[model samples]
Target: MTQQPVDDIEIVAALFQLARSGAIYTKEVLLIEAKKLFPDVPEERLLDCRRQLGERLKGSDYLGYSDEYDRQRRRKAS
Candidate 1:
């Protein structure tokens, strides 16, 4: 059977979906999750997804969202 192909847009879309879920998703987990969504995503595109995800997230206004995810992540790391 032929393996399905993955695309950059799909990977970025998954990142956005995960963020909307309000979970503390890290770069590593996000990559894994993206893999699950698009098993055939190229490693290069996956790397780009990480960069794009960060760019989009860094520009987002956290005003409408709670910091629980952020605080919990910090506490766990600490």
Candidate 2:
């Protein structure tokens, strides 16, 4: 059986939803699932998507997964 092809937007959306729903926690787990959806996707692309999502989802009532990247930024700014 062939796996369905997923686009970047779809992958990002899935990751966002999963994070918000508490289905995915760390970046490691997110990549594992993202690869399942789009096997040919590169890790760099997924990392980029994760960065974008963290920016978009920060401080917008998303209490599911804390943005560790933003936390690091705060730690550095202090």
Candidate 3:
């Protein structure tokens, strides 16, 4: 069987899928894995991806998923 070629889009999708499935959790952990997969990506861009993925995974039961904490933090920062 031919293996699918890995790319940035596929990698990001897999990361998000894992989070959605409750396999991988925590935005920090996801960002770390993303950096490992695409070390050349800019830090700011990675953070943006992290934020976007986090938003998409909202309400998931993934380990470390925490909308409440995020909201509380945002309220405190406001």
Among these predictions, the greatest TM-score belongs to 2
Q: TM-score order of candidates, best first?
A: 2, 1, 3
lDDT of candidate 3 over 1-78, digit per residue (tens): 985555545655767766777756687777777788667778777777666655666656477548677778999999
Clashing pairs in 1: none
| Predicted candidate 1 versus true structure: per-residue lDDT over 1-78, tens digit per residue | 986666667678778888678774577777777777666667678879879877776668467343666778899999
| Candidate 1 error regions (>4 Å) | 1-7, 60-78
Question: Of models 2 and 3, which has the larger TM-score?
Answer: 2
Q: After superposition, how far is residue 40 of candidate 3 from its true place, in Å?
A: 0.7
Considering summed lDDT, which 10 consecutive residues are worst modelled in model 1? Answer: 61-70
Q: Is candidate 1 or candidate 2 better by lDDT?
A: 2
TM-score per model over all chains: 0.57, 0.61, 0.49
Model 3 steric clash pairs: none
Q: Which stretches of candidate 3 lie over 4 Å from their true place?
A: 1-12, 59-78
lDDT of 2 by residue, 6-65 (tens): 676777798888778888779789878877766688888888887777667665646745
